[model samples]
Target: MRLSRYFLPVTKETPADAQIVSHKLMLRAGLVRQTAAGIYAWLPLGLRVLKKIEQIVREEQDKAGAVELLMPTIQSADLWRQSGRYDAYGPEMLRLVDRHEREMLYGPTNEEMITTIFRDATKSYRDLPRTLYHIQWKFRDEVRPRFGVMRGREFLMKDAYSFDLDEEGLKQSYEAMFVAYLRTFARLGLQAVPVRAPTGPIGGDLSHEFHILAETGESQLFYDAAIDDVTREELLAADASTIARLTRLYAMEAEEHEKVAECPVPAERLRSRRGIEVGHIFAFGTKYSASMGFSIQTADGGQVHPQMGSYGIGVSRLMGAIIEASHDDNGIVWPDSVAPFQVGLINMRADDAACSAAADNIYKQLETAGVETLYDDRDERGGAKFATMDVIGLPWQLVIGPKGLEKGVVELKRRASGEREELSLETALARLTAR
Candidate 1:
């Protein structure tokens, strides 16, 4: 993508309403714009990042043996009513009435709808174990939606529903998703700690919330320091035993930690920090199926309610959570895996014929090599171009200038660390395009 043609509206001044680091940085970086109090329109740069995150979530879900299918944003109110949650769900539920005098709603979650679909489609015990997932927009009427996408009323979510014949099957599906969440966060360059959490409105007996540590986080957490020692490789290689081991580690939110009279970890081993929740999984046996009278035939030919579990990863909120955990004073320090563009190719002297030719040649080489590069061909000052590159936070910046070209070398700088190296144009291209 060329910056000259891109619709990036980056600003130097931070919005006064943005209280958190992610919200402020997101605005300043021109990733998103607020259309309403709790709704945001994702700009071009922001949409790229959002889609990248969504794809990662989708890939991880697929690895967990979940099949993908899309669900509608709007759902029939009769679904929630059958689940007995329409009245009890409170103001967050965006209730609506259609012209035909029928009730409807923008679904906050798809437990009721998914249950109906799965129940009507499967009748025999052969379809006992199935996990279906969807990446879609969800809406909830938050009373005070703030902190940008972190607590937005309208957001993208990756929700997976697992249907099993019994409690044991549900546990297996839940563990699979738990491990999937760990791997997903690790790939996204986040250290997510899974802590036992209350089911709340989901009404599950077993639940876990995955949180990323950040000072600006809303939830206070007490966890074993050993949790931090686990590497991304270890998480990616995780299995049922690894999942079992991780769950045994001490990790809980403030509310849950306060309920315990005896703290398990030694004072030195126990660490306290603030956290932003990015994912949640619930093993709610027969909650939706029983409530909605959804039943299937068992092996013994008896009617039985299928056990269900729901897993959710906040696809949109992750951008804010990642920024909160990764940004520095300069701007966002995007993880290479989730970065919109792998390299920011800067024509430092766009007005100079030599610099423009060199930068343009390198950009063409990068494109041919299948690199996602954002070439800054704008007729702007070198300082402004550099600043834009830093704020957007691509993993690398390749600067082309007349002086460097005259010396037969170009500058390659890593965004995370302010480290730069001057190498021959051929060498720099080789380094970037190397697999």
Candidate 2:
């Protein structure tokens, strides 16, 4: 993508209303624009990052034996009514009356709808276990939506519902999603700790929320420091035993920690930190199924409600969470996996014939090598181009300047470590493509 043709509307001045680092950086970096309060228009650059995150979530879900299927944003109010939660859901749900005078709603969650769908499709015990997921936009009427996408009224979410015939089956499905969540966060370059959390509106005795540790998080957490010792490799290949070990480790929100009579974690082993919630899973058993009239026939010819679980990852909120966890003073330092573009190819002196030619050639080479490179071919100053590159936070910045071109070298800089080295054109190409 060429900056000259791109629609990035970056600004140097931070908006006065922007309160958090991720919110401010997202605006300054031209990742998103506020269309309404608590709602955003994801610009091209931001959309790329979002899609990358969504794909990773999708892949991890698929690996965990969950099948993918898209669900609609709008759901029938009758679905909630059947589940005995229409009025119970409260004002956060955007309830409305359609043109036909039928009660309707923008679904905040799909428990009721998914239960109805699964129930109508499966009648016998043959379809005992199934996990289906969808990535879709969800809306909640937040009274005070703030911190950009971190607490937005409208956001994208990956929600999966698991249906099982018995309690034991639900446990297996929950564990699969638990492992999937760990691997998903690890793949996104986040150190997310799974902490036992209240089921709240979801209504389940078993629930865990995956929170990514960040200084600016909304929740204070008390956890066993050993949770951090579980390596990324282990998380990627985590099994039921891994889940058991992690669950046994003491981890809780401040609210939950306050309720405990005595903490099991030794003071030395207890680590308190702030964390932002990114993913949550609930083993709600028959909450939705039973209430929504979803039941299958048993082998003994008895009707039984299917045990169910719901897993959710904040797909759009993850962008803000990642920025909160990863950004520095300059701007967002995006992880390679979720970076909009892997490399920023800047023509430091676009007006200079030599610089332009070299940058164009290098951009071609990078693209041909299957590297997602954003080429800054605009007739802009070197400093401005460099600033844009830094703010956007591409993993690598390849600067082709007149001076560097003359010396048969280009400046290659790594965004995370701020490491810069001069490499010959061929050498730089080889290094960038090798990965």
Candidate 3:
């Protein structure tokens, strides 16, 4: 992508309505624009980041034996009626009427719809233990939708549904998703702590919300400090015992937290911090299946309601969460795994032919090497180009200038740390494409 042809509408002044750092930075960086209250049009740069996060979530879901299928944003209100939640789900449900005067809604969640799908498709225990997922947009009528995408009324979500024959099977399926969530967050360069959470409308006895610590987060969390060292690989291979070992540690959100007297961990081990919720998992047993009359034939030819679980990761909200956890004073310091572009190629002297030729050559080399590079070929001052690159926060920045080209060198700077090194053009290309 070349900045000269890009549609980035970066601004020098922050929007007064943006109360959080992620909201302000997202606006200033030209990632997204608000079309309505809590509704946004994801600009090109923002769309790239959203897609990257979606793909990572998809890959992790696949690794956990979940199959992918997309679902529609709009659903029949009868689905909720059958599940006895049509009246129970409050104003957050965006209710409406179609041309035929039939009750309809933009789905806030898909539990009832998925349960209906499973019931109609499967008839016996042989089809048990199936996990299905979709990445799609969802709408909720938030009374006060603020904090940019973090609490947007319209957002992208990765929601997975698991069907099993019994409680034991449900536990196994739930563990798989729990571990997958840990690996997913780890790969995205986040330290997500799984805290025991109350399943409000989901109506599940067992639930956990994965939170990333940030100073400006909305949720106050109490957790054990040891959760910081848990690795993705370890979680991937974890068994029931291992999963229990990790979950046994004290962790809860502020609403559920009682007191230090009730905490299992000692004062030294317990840590309190503000965190943003990015993912949630639930084991709802037969809540939906029983309510919707979804039953499968057992080995003994008896009808039994299939146990159920749902796992959700806020695909769009993660952009804000990542920024909240990772950015500095300059701008967003995107983690390489989820950055919109891996490298930002800057033509520091865009007006100079020698610098332009060198930058063009390096850009071509990077393209040939299968690198995602954004070339800043705009006719702008060197300082302006640098500032824009910093605001966007690519993992690596390749600085090409007349001075560096004349000396047979290019400057490579790491965005996370303000560290720069002058290396030969060949060496710089080699290092950038080494991964």
Candidate 4:
């Protein structure tokens, strides 16, 4: 992608209404634009990052034996009514009347709808343990939707629902998703701690919320410091015992953490930090199935409500969460795994013919080598080009300047670290491609 042909509308001045670093930088970096209060139109760059996060979530879900299927944004209000939550869910539910005067809503969650689907499809225990998920947009009608995408009223989400015939099957299914969430966040360059949390409207006795630590986060969390040492591979291969070991450690949100006297961990082992809730898992046994009359036949030919669990990850909110956890003074320092583009190819001397030619050739080489490169071929000053690249925060910046090109070298810089090295074009291409 060439910057001259791109639609990035970066700004020098930050929006006055923007409160947090992620909100301010997202505006300044031209990632998204506010179309309404608590709603946004994801610009090209922002959409790329959102899609990358979505794909990662999908891959992890697949690994955990969950099948993918999309559900509609709009759901029948009757679904909620059948589940006995039509009146219970408050103003956050975006309820509306359709053309026929039928009550409908933009779904805030899909527990009822998924339960209905499972009931209609499966009649016996043979179809017992099935996990289905979808990545889709949801509307909550937040009274005060601020902090950019972090608390947006309209946002993307990955919601998975698991159906099992028995408690043991439900436990196993929940553990799979629990481990998958750990791996998902780790791959996205986040250190998320799973803390015991309230189920709220989801109505589960067992629940955990995965929070990513950040200084500007909304939730105050208390957790054991040992959570920081867990690895992705270890979590992915974890069993019931492994999960129990981690869950036994002290971890809770501020509201629950306030009862410090009840906490098991000593003062030294307990760590407090502000964190953003990126993922949540619930093992709500028969909450929706029983309410919605979703029952399967047991081996003894008796009807039994299928146990269920729901797992959710805020797909769009993750962009803001990542920025909150990863950005520096300059701009977002995107991790390579989720960066919009792996390399930013800047023609520092865009007006110089030699520099332009070299940059063009290098860009082609990078593309041919399957590296996602953004070529800054705009007729702009070197400083401006560098600043723009930094603001976007690709993993690497390949600068082709007149002086460097004349010396048979190009400057390669790591965005995370302000480290630079002058190397031959061949060498630069090799390193970037290898990454």
Candidate 5:
């Protein structure tokens, strides 16, 4: 991708309605455009980032031994009626009447639909403990949807469902999703703290909301400051005991905070911050299954309703949440794992012969090395090119200019740190690919 050929539109002025930093930044960056009060059209740059986040979620879900499938964006109201939520669910449900006056809706969640799917084929305890997931578009009609993609009406989401035999089986299946969520957030470079949250519409006895701390975040949380160093490997190496230990270690929502006598830490050491809930998991036993007649024969020759757990990650919300968690005054500082492009090749003097030649060489080398890069071959000024690249914020920047081309070296700069080092072309490529 090149600035000369790319469609990244950036604006210096922030929109007045964008009350939050992430929202403001997203609009200024030309990542999204508002089509209605709450609906947004994802531009090229935003779509690229969303796809990257989706890929990371997919990989983590696969690692957790969950199978993937696609579900429809629209569903029949008959399923919701069987679950007795057709009238109970309020305006958030985008209900409709079809040509034949049939009830229909753009699904806000897939509990009713997934239950219908499961009951249609699954009929035995042998096929118990099945986890199926899908990444698709979901619609929830928010009355006052604002904050860019953070609270959009139509957004991409990854929702997975697990079905098991009984309470004991439900607990194990819940842990599998719990572990999977931990790894998913870690791989996306988010320090998500699992906090017990109230089950809103998703009825369940057990629930956890994953929050990433940021000033512009929506959820207020209490968590251990040490969670900043949490990693995916810790979650992947976990079992039943490991899940309990990890959950018991520390963290809770504002309502669940403890004020008892315990490990004494100063008030400043106790970190309470605002965060956005990117993902949530809950175990609702026999709720949808019982309503939909999803019964299977057990060993004792009796029909039983299966326990189910649902896990959700806001695939599109993550783009905004990530920006909220990790950005500076200049622009978005995309984390290495989820950056749209790993390396940005800047030809400081794209019109000049020597600089263009050197940049072309570097771009080819990076491509051969299997690096995702954007070559800024545009005839923009050095400051303009640098600022645009900085706003997009690739993990690394390879600066090739006429002055540096004379020295037989290029400048390498890390997006996180402003420091720059001049290195031989060969050395620069080696250092980038080595890691």
Candidate 6:
């Protein structure tokens, strides 16, 4: 992907309406454009980042034993009616009347429809523990949608539903998602703490929202600082002897917080911090299943309403949250795991024969070697090109200028660290290949 051939419409001026750093940078970078008050049309760059985040969410969900299947964004209101929340749901529910005068809606969540699926397919406890998920768009008519994707009216989300015959079975499904959230955030380079949170519209007795700490975050979180230090591998590798160890760790939302000395985390490890809710899991025993008759027959000839749980991760909002957690003054510093491109190759003087040739060769070599890179072969000044490259935040950057090309060297600068070193062409290639 050459800069000259790319559709990135970066601007130097920040929009006056953007109130936060993440929102401002996203607009300046032209990653997204406002389609309405709280809706956006994701530009090429934003869409790429969205896909990368979506893939990571999907992989980690699969690893946690959840299967994937897509559900439609638009759902019939009849489903919600059966759940007894169709008209009771607030204005956030975008209710509408179709051409046939049938009540319908853009689904804000999928609990009702999922129940219909379960009730039709499974008749016995044999399929007791089933978890299915989908990555799709959702709509909520936010009265005052603001903060870019953080509180958008329309967005992408990964929602998974779990159905189990008994409380014992439901616990297993909940634990799977609990651990999955940890791994998903860790893999994306986020230190997310799972705090007990309100289920809101998705009623439940047990719920936890995985919050990623960021200064510009919307949620007020109080957490055990130790949660940040624990890694996904540690939690996933824990044996049955201490399987619930991670859950026992202290963490909670402002609402569920208890100012008691019994909190297991040490005083030093307790920090009241602000964070964005990226993922949430809930165990709503029989809420959706009982409402819609999604029951399985027990061996004793009794009907049992399957307990249910729903897990959600804001797939699109995560892109903005990642930028918020990781960016500096320059621009978006994308984490390598979800970076749209791993490296950027800039021809400092695209018109110069030597610089152009070297950069072209390096770009081709990197691509041939299976490296995702952006070749900035544009008719722009060196400073402008460098600034743009820094803001785009590729992990590694290769700069070939006429001056450096004459010495058979190019400037290799890493984005994470503003460290630049002149390296011979062979050495630069080697470092990039090793990455």
C-alpha displacement of 101 in model 3, angstroms?
0.9
Q: Provide the lDDT at 9 for model 2.
A: 94
lDDT of 2 by residue, 248-320 (tens): 9989999878755599988889899999999999999899888878889999999999999999999999999
Tens digit of per-residue lDDT, candidate 1, span 238-257: 88887877887889999877
Candidate 5 lDDT by residue in tens digits, 110-133: 999888888898889998889899
- In model 5, where do residues sit more than 4 Å from their true spots? 224-233, 236-238, 255-270
TM-score of each: 0.99, 0.98, 0.98, 0.98, 0.95, 0.96
Worst 10 residues of 6 by lDDT: 235-244
Q: Work out candidate 5's RMSD over C-alphas.
A: 2.2
Instruction: Write candidate 4's Cα lDDT for 129-190 as tens digits.
Output: 99999999999999999999999999999999999989999999999999888888878988
RMSD of 2: 1.0
lDDT of 3 by residue, 278-369 (tens): 99999999899998888889999999999999999999999999999999888999999999999999998888988898899899999999
Tell me the alpha-carbon RMSD of every candidate: 1.0, 1.0, 1.2, 1.1, 2.2, 1.8
User: Ten consecutive residues with minimal summed lDDT in candidate 1?
Assistant: 255-264
| Residue-pair clash count for candidate 2 | 0
In angstroms, the error of model 2 at 350 is 1.3
For model 1 the TM-score comes to 0.99
